[model samples]
Target: MLALNKIRPGVNGLAVIEREVREPGPGEMLVRVHAAGVCGTDMQLYHGAGAFAQRLKLPTTLGHEMCGTVIALGPEAATPQGAGRVKVGDLVSLESHIPCWNCNACRTGRAHVCPNTRYPGIDIDGCFAQYITVPTSIAWVNPPGTAPKLAALLEPLGIAVHATLEGRGVSGQTVVVNGCGPIGLMNVAVARHFGARRVIAIDPNAKRRQMALQMGADEALDPTAAPPVQTVRDLTHGELAGVVFEYTGSPDGVRNTFAMVGALGDVRWCATPGQPMDFDFGAWRKSRPTIYNIHGRRLWDTWDVAAPLVYENHIDLQPIASHEIPLADSPRAFALILAGEAIKPLILCE
Candidate 1:
């Protein structure tokens, strides 16, 4: 088998390499990779650009958001917690985080932030290969007949789900999504699907703003030109949005969040910036809105929020899948993303 390997640290270290297929060990299973999505985190790893990438070692497989068919299961002896849930020929989506159940974060209902996390494509071999091995615990069974390409996005969509539905009221409330990247745009659709009264999508990129419209946003704005707070207020007839979602990782977006959201509204920061942001406590004090720093999906909770929406075809992912490439051509694939032509690229490894 051949896998996309990050052979060393830093940029220019990854390549396609040959490898033997490893059978599932106890508590693990072998999956035949079908469709995988190249993600921003994957790009960050490619560029060695952040603290998240610093934790990674070399000689690891290079993709994570994927869906595959279960090829083989480990012998049934004391399997992982989610074991006995899948069998040969079952199609499943991959949950990229591997958490140690013993950690305080895990024990106290915050496993999504488990410090001891094993993220494939970083901490271990990943899915950008014809065959890959993942613990049964991280595999989620998909509905029969789900599109593999869209199923590949399940992992990232879980983030949008966690950010949108994790104890915040969106139904009938105006919402502002301050970015139109793939996940950011997905957040727009998820908010709309949750029956948000008006969904405003903000981005400087014309292409992404247009994509946001396609995903069901009521309006799209050029963040640089339109004063997001005032624009949203106008769109809602002198009332600002009740919820503001920050996914731009830009300081301007952060600054605008407190302004875009209405008094007593909610603000959720879902994207992590490359640098620490300086925030004003004064605006936050005045707005009096609840703020949430959205970590990744809330384990099984976000999955439950996402699965039905995906299975029911309520949230569309096709428009965001801008490019598809073969695993051997992943180097070019990553380049395309860096070049900004492809927002979400899918790699077909099988």
Candidate 2:
């Protein structure tokens, strides 16, 4: 079995090594990894930016945004006999983070924010391995015609879905996405699909700004070239943005989020800030705009809405999937992302 592991901090090390996979425990199913998406969260883990790697018990397999095929089921599992609900070969996409169902947050239907959460590829062994055993509860069966490469993006799409839907519906509203990263680009399409009158995308990178336009942004603004706040306001006919999705973790981006939002509108922030942010409460108070800090995709809340978008071809991910490489070339894939050359790199794990 081949697997990629983060043996320690600040090093890729001998991450991809051969190993044997143990059999599934009770209530577990062994999945043969088919495809895994290299997410920004994975980059943060590689660079030791977030608290993810620090909390992890090291020498762990490192992959979370993944899809696989169920190969085996545990003895105690009720999975059907031959090719039952999910048989020997059933394509599936995993949710990655599974909450302790007994926790207070889980009981209150806030499982996405559950404090006691175990995430694959972060807190526990992940799909970087050729084979991974996971609880069936977190696995979703992909429809027959869904592309494995596209299926790998469902997790990140769920994030965009959750973030954009957090505010009052974006339909016929003006929206500005504060970053043009992969997730931010996804939001541009999502907001457009939901009937946002105008979608303004902001980024420092020239290529990404163009990519945002390609991905359905009505206007792409390079914040470094001209002030994005003024640009967004101008695009909105001096109305400011009815809704703003802040996906950049930089201080400038965060501060600009407050500036770009319309009075009495909502700002949905999904970026994980590495440091404390300095906010202008006076300005926010005066504007009376609402701020919504998004964590994980609102559990299953937004998935229902997003799944249909994908199923009905309302949002296409082909443009955003900038690179597709085999699992053996993961090191190169990581390098491409670290260099900011690739948008969404999907590794073929099968």
Task: Report the number of the highest-TM-score candidate.
Answer: 1
Candidate 2 backbone collisions, by pair:
none
Best by lDDT: 1
Per-residue lDDT of 68 in model 2:
86
**Cα error, candidate 2, residue 189 (Å):** 0.8
Which window of 10 residues has the lowest lDDT sum in candidate 1?
74-83
**lDDT for 156 (candidate 1):** 91
True-structure lDDT of candidate 2: 0.81
Give the alpha-carbon lDDT of every model.
0.86, 0.81
* Candidate 2's TM-score: 0.95
Per residue, candidate 1 scores C-alpha lDDT tens digits across 155-232 of: 999998888885566898989999888899899999998889889999988888889999998899997886877878
